[model samples]
Target: MSRIADIAAALAGYDPKALSVDGVQAFLAELVAPAILRERERVPLFEALGRVLAEDVVSPFNVPPHDNSAMDGFAFDGAVLDTPSSGFVSLRVAGTAFAGTARHGALTRGDALKIMTGAVMPAGFDTVVPQEFCTVDGDTVRFPANALRPGDNRRFAGEDLRQGLPALLQGERLTPAGLGLLASLGQAEAPVLRRLRVAYFSTGDEILSLGEPPREGAVYDSNRYTVFGLLTRLGCQVVDLGMVRDDPAALADALTDAAERADAIITSGGVSVGEADHTRAVMKQLGDMAFWRVAMRPGRPMAVGLIPRSSAGDAHEGAAVLFGLPGNPVAVMVTFLAFVRPALLRLMGCNAANAAPPPMLRARSVAPIRKKPGRTEYQRGRVTCLPGALPEVRIAGNQGSGVLSSMVEGNGLVVLHHAQGSVAPGDEVDVMMFDGVV
Candidate 1:
């Protein structure tokens, strides 16, 4: 078999989906088990948010070490309670207890203590009376005899958490709210998975760095930034290797540097049999590589492999995994979402067995769409919804992979099936909304 044909067969072992994105996602799950390979590190609570937990976290103690007042009120023994219709009763103010300060005094008959929210209620004081309904002056306070029920205005100890209970499970990503919960439990540090280190860059001389003037036939490099932002959103530490020329020497040097430090290296373009493409040749010299003619549109010639390091000695046995994406801007995007994202996630230790994007939503297309019935297509779209109507999505002006303008202005990708042809107006289509774009 030809080199390209052999590579194609090797990639086919990954089981690309004919038209279903789900099938592609399933294939990725098998290839990238993000939850398996990464190690955990302890981080300050302030820096723990968005980091996945390395293992189940157990609380050192109960959330509330003791029963406390849930509101600003009075703490007294509940034995004084009688009928609901009883009139006001007077009591002597024993002392004041505030949140975060323990109560030093206890309650006795005809005695009440002023308590604030979260204040530890004194022992034998099982109920609280709000100052609103009660009158307080000097050391004396009075409340309606029926103001509170048993255990009113009180938060029982361990109600929020029990001692040694699992506060959080492994593989759960921490959030601001989760951090606060940990704070309430008195945890200052968290055991979290270490950030996954990834190296990626744009390929081809036709791609220019942003802020540089574009010459004829040249476009500013956008995929590197796009993928970089996405990886940051996933909390991965990324090393931007910059743009690589389509020459074997330059490509080999860049790949070598990236393989030395990164868990994986990803590049866009020059993986196909294009005349100027040298990525495949370099991959051959460095490590095993495979090109996949995946049965999908927007991205067809996708490549995956490892770049071997011959000089790293026997310590470096396996090579750094690589992804060579297509040159088209949109194709780079679709292929990355379908393949690379999951693998990166797995490497990050997030239990990211796969990188399946959120489920697609069914929406009505506002205009007609043209396409053949072979490769699946991801068309850029703009979406808007009226208050009482379902969201209506319209295709962007261009479908060409090089048109970065459409991607900049669009909010979602409207997917067309392999068996499905041109879509008429008002036709229902599956649209993947770009939520959480970094």
Candidate 2:
């Protein structure tokens, strides 16, 4: 808790009054320390999907283990290709070799062994000419010298992975392909960082829960479901705390309960001004919180801090980080995408390189957009390729904070950065794609 203050004070221009988008990122980067060092668990390959690899997966043996054929062809000494006097290379068809069995005699210099894909290359054979390219007459097979090169269609031992080299590096997020790679290395299980626990809830008396009847001026809570999906997609053990009203004691109790059980807490609503909410006051009493009116549109009202671990004394790992986001649907999403998600990844044991901002796509605006300088704005946009031209983008319906439909309609968010002016029809802009995020 004390270190967080020291960290913020150490920043060159630390200003909670008017923090920039980049400022929020920098603060989080400085504050977050990966939870990977705390502990790791060994999980079977089947259960390791999406888990962060805690250690490098060193290959136990060469991937192929032996030189093998990559195609169904005839394997012969590569030197024979250059030794041919005629324009064609010729060899005696010795014997056939099939996949999964390497039961062929060593081939002589002029002898070619019929081999199937994955068949071990017979001794003295280093090249293969696909059967489709060779003409067989009696026992001899003939092919053009230029038809194949030396070592063609041959998979060398250790070609895919060397025995001593790391097959998968530490901090890698295991995917289906990674699972297959591990299987190739004959690994049955993997060492991975333990899953992160995150608890989230919505705040505001006007926000109604599902199954509740609608009332005038009160909207159903969409932030909980959206946040839940986002957290689940992030591979965290999400603790759904439902929705908390604007009451002070209830908000405090909810935050306290979440902090005790989870690594982080996410709360939407009550961060905005002119609202009779106790979110700020409750945070001040229970945690070391910093409220910020960030220099960003839709999601400008945000808070970040740490809640002390009241349940655990010496056994406690550390304090839980807090993310106080806006109440609006789009704002909550934008803030989460722009800030909370990256911080959570860092906390989830992702290395610095892996936790970097998600890459954005460059696209040309399809129309003029009005904008002012000094603050960043995220606009929902639909991007499409124009065949010959660069990818172009247009606004996606109404860009309202409450408009979740626009987020659905848009494939991405056109990122208008701080200090940037209005955009013209042909202006190029950076867009954060929602392909996997949404």
Candidate 3:
């Protein structure tokens, strides 16, 4: 074993089955620090959705560029209503103005213009009376006393934005609303962080391809699809390398190809200490591998490494990071969210996207909860919010990572503390909602 490997092994303790999930998460984060982002690119506004921003976006012009009206009414001064029983003064309608028009004319005393909502408020007119409140007869509008305020109906120019302001900071992922903001500022193209090229694969002979006959004790591969969806959601350019058997040579070749073509390589299964697990052996031959047993349940064994491939004939030179998740579906999903997602975001140059939000929701446990001490458990659960009350969460049908139905039926992940052994019915706990489901 290499010196780094030995140190890692000593620091991480033994027994893959005994590694806590928290330990594994911290180890993974430390192992994959400083993942450099790819190159930058200028893409159209339509194509920039979901892409990370390469540079700060500044507004060339202020929003609303000019002062506008907030309501459809007669534009006049509010001080004219200081006297009581003013007895309906009729102001001459000088002209009409609408939104997006330049107001070159100014209002005079006893002269009001019919202004529409969003219309540029003419200089000298500080208030607007809703057209519904006053009757317009020919060129005169009858204004009631105290019908308007000095600034009640005016929307000042640049109130929404200022000229040349830093509207968006660098490392912001473009969302639909973000794109709308860009469009409003007349930005047709955007400078965005280049898409991350991620390579993925699944191991184990028991994992069959879609539409393939399932052999006894074998299950169809779903991790690839799930990871693909998750990566897509994260705006990654995924390259599916398909499934490989538990052969050391085949695994090495796949890793080599992935390192050359992708910035990061993600694989499921085959890193455990079992005899059929050749992923660790292949990684050791290729690069620096660190296997850690975390303190979290559902996910325990995970592998992180910086692959150092030799520049021999047909081999790649630069290092490509590796994340070896567990074969179990739930374990793989949880591990990816807790560990892989942060690294991926850093590699994509998104600063805030990697931050994990707290799952501190109030939930009442409907059934008895059983968990061992010293391991944090993310119990798949279904949560329902009672109107005007806290949400209630119950464990899904089963807690096994291999049970796909459990995740499908779950609305959230009920987080049980590492020291909490078990809880009886009606105990309140914290749950993280999935897809915003309560």
Candidate number with greatest lDDT: 2
> Candidate 1 vs candidate 3: which has greater TM-score?
3
Question: What TM-score quantifies how close candidate 3 is to the native fold?
Answer: 0.86
Q: Rank the candidates by TM-score, best first.
A: 2, 3, 1
lDDT of 3 by residue, 324-417 (tens): 9999998988778767877777677776543343346788898899877888888889998899877888888888888878888997788887
Candidate 3's clash total is: 10
For TM-score, candidate 1 versus 2, the one ahead is: 2
Question: Each candidate's TM vs. the true structure?
Answer: 0.76, 0.95, 0.86
Q: Comparing candidate 1 with candidate 3, which one achieves the higher lDDT? A: 3
Give the Å error, residue 84, model 1. 1.7
**Top TM-score model:** 2
Off by over 4 Å in 2: 34-37, 313-317, 386-389
In order of listing, the candidates' clash counts read 1, 0, 10
Q: For model 1, what is the C-alpha lDDT against the true structure?
A: 0.76
By summed lDDT, the worst window of 10 consecutive residues in model 1 runs over: 310-319
Candidate 3 worst ten-residue window by lDDT: 308-317
Residues 1-438, candidate 2, lDDT per residue (tens digit)?
366688788888888888899999998887666333346899999899888888898998998999999999899999877877788998899989898886745557988998999999888889989999999999999999988788899999999999999999888778899999999988899999888889999999898999999999999999999999999888889999999989999998999999888888999988866558788789888877788989998798998888888675221256788999998999999999999988888887877777777799999999998989988999999999888888999999999999999999999999999999999999999999998677
lDDT of 3: 0.79
Extract clashing residue pairs from model 1: 34-346
